[model samples]
Target: MEVRKLHPLFAAELIGADVSDPQNRELIDTVEDAMREYAVLCIRGQGHINDQQQLAFARAFGPLELPPGNNAPGVKSRIAPGLYSASNLDANGEIVALESRSAKIAKGNELFHADSSFNDMPSKWSILRGVIIPPERGDTQFIDMRAVYEALPQAMKDRIADLKAEHSYAHSRRKAGADADDNLPMFKYMRAVQPMVKQSPSGRPTLFVGAHAERVIGMDEEEGTALIEELLAFAEQPQFIYSHKWQPGDIVIWDNRCTLHRGTEFDYLRYKRDMRRANVNESGEERCAIPAEALTQHYQQLSKAEAAN
Candidate 1:
């Protein structure tokens, strides 16, 4: 496999390797090594991969998280349990209405975030495959947290080194002008407290703040928001970012532990952009085992209480 650097700081494109075959141990190891170095890796021309093949390849990293909203009643997903539908299409294979709840919720994705940061065990690797690429626009932009951390002023780094921030899916959605209580399985009132600076698997300290990060624990609310925004502004500088344009059959893998990503705008109402993603949890020891039935039940109760109000 040949590696081509996509950006000065952290992303690369790997050529001459097929990831569809999960049993290729050498290929998997090579990809993992590349991830430690690049933080983000794109393997183009993977349009031939089927759902089963994609899941198998994603599992090579670790156990997969059940896609959000998979437990919704009567919703049959084309992409299967382990893969999250990152597309604008509905379960019926139709483009969702712009005013629909799903579309509104998706607006939150436009803000940079580490996947599943609100969960107790945040995700590790997010492997996304482009099934239907739009003719133009809709690129995924990534920020290298490792680089961002390194560029921070010493005093700023010291200030955040021992601080913990609260992350919530609801908080980010609300920030995006979407309803926090939207009833999506993942949108429920859940929060995870994580250190602002954490060691990545690569042994580098990374800034963990993102859109999902609500506030720094023990600090005044407004003060925490200011700090988060300041760090985000610093990280948004062009030199630390890589924007990946999608191509049908392309599979892009990013480490959520050391990167933040956001989707760029596209003519979603006119074009079909079917992207599916499989997320691997941070570790096998702390794998999230939230039962589908339990999530379904919790949401049902929430809905009932809302209706009563």
Candidate 2:
């Protein structure tokens, strides 16, 4: 199988391999490397994969996360809702126009963000498949945090170099006029304080801002929040985005470790959507202060790997 780079910053298309091919180590590594370098991947031709097959494919990257309690049918503890479920029917499993608010919430995720940014232990990766997609309605979007980091002004970069942010899922959910806290498990009050601008452990630059970034460390609450909102806007420029229009046989794998993303809200009232997702973990990822200089090196390694086979 071969991988095609979609952008110099992030995103790729895996066109020459099958994911459910018995868990080959090299292929898994190749996929992981692609995700590390590109952050997001769209793979076509997979109409035959079922839940078990989907879950199996996702497990290749890591473990699955439990679904949040507010999820629809087929929701599990670690699985993210599929990209197409935005307009799917729950009753009799008919899957028509998306009816649930939870489903609509999925549609509004087009913004860049780390998965579960609201949680202290956010998920590390996500695998989503388009089980049913409208001819033109349900495209998934992605952005390159690493690229955003690279583009920051030196003064701004240095200003945020040692800063950290508070990420809270409940906070964002509440602002959406929804109750997210009741669904997520409660933990110690302490939240994730990851660097506002992180250099991935692999020595890649990664900006960690997202919709869920509630505040910054050591700053007044009001000021920190304003800062968070301002930066999140800057990171989500149209030039930084790649939107994926789906086909039934298409699958997507993304890295949450280095990028933040949101699902776009579409005309779920007019089209049916159903998707399945599986997730992997990086809850145990070691946080470090070292900045990566492998920006170009990482991209080269991934492209080379893609060419090798």
Candidate 3:
């Protein structure tokens, strides 16, 4: 398999690999090394990949679908449980489950923060394949956090080096048009603490910023909001961003631990962009519920009042 860089830091397209039945141990190592070098890898000619084949291929890098607390149907938390599945619509004509027990416990792609960061046990990697691409508009846009960090002005870089942010699903889901059930604030208490910017495990400098980042650890609410927005503007440059026009049977993997990604909006009302998502858990990572102490006084009091009611 030949590895071709798709961007300065964000993506690389792998050609000449039969991803459907990837058995060559050497090829797997090469892909893993490439993934380490580049946060995202796009393998184009994945015509023969089934769910099991895809899962095995993804396992060469690290663990597969096995999230400690976050589990999904037809997927088990094993080294290679064939976690690779379609993230789009299901065969019976249903939306790729936005509301459910597993997903509620396991945060879906609602925020910009990395995947599985809330559950003390975060995931290692996420491999999503584009099984059925739309005719005209099923493009996934990826931003390079590594590039974002490299391009940061020295002043800003120094400011965020050791900073942390509050990540929550309730806050971000509400922003993304979910969170309708006010009584059941399942996401209100789901939050995570992660560094704002750090050197990736792969030796790449990446800014771990995302929509779920509620605020900087000590900054005022408004100031925190402004800071994240500013970073968003900086990282989302057309020069640093890559807009991949997905094709059917395109297998793509991303390192959620360090990168922040967003699925671009399309004409959901007119078009169907059915695909499946599969994530591999990273072990020994600790996750916790949002602390009551960290909450604003108003929301803190509300929790008390609700109990009395």
Q: In what order do the candidates fall by TM-score, top score first? A: 1, 2, 3
- Ranking 1 against 3 by TM-score, winner: 1
Q: By TM-score, how accurate is candidate 3?
A: 0.77
Who wins the lDDT comparison? 1
Question: What is the lDDT, from 0 to 100, of the residue 308 in candidate 3?
Answer: 98
Residue 86 lDDT, candidate 2, scale 0-100: 33
lDDT of 3 by residue, 1-309 (tens): 688998765689888878654578777777778878787888876756776776666655555544222332232332233343333444455444545432332233533456655544566677777666667764667777887788899999999889888876655665566532334333444567878876776887779877667678899999988998899788777787777788888877778766766665554445555454567666642222233333344244545766896
Tens-digit lDDT track of model 1 for 133-208: 8999999999999999999999999999899999988898899998776464545536789899988878999999
- RMSD, each candidate, Å? 2.3, 12.6, 6.7
Q: Which ten residues in a row have the lowest lDDT in candidate 3?
A: 67-76
Per-residue lDDT of model 2, residues 80-134, tens digit only: 3322233355645554444455554453354456766555555778888877787
lDDT of 1: 0.87
Top TM-score prediction, candidate number: 1
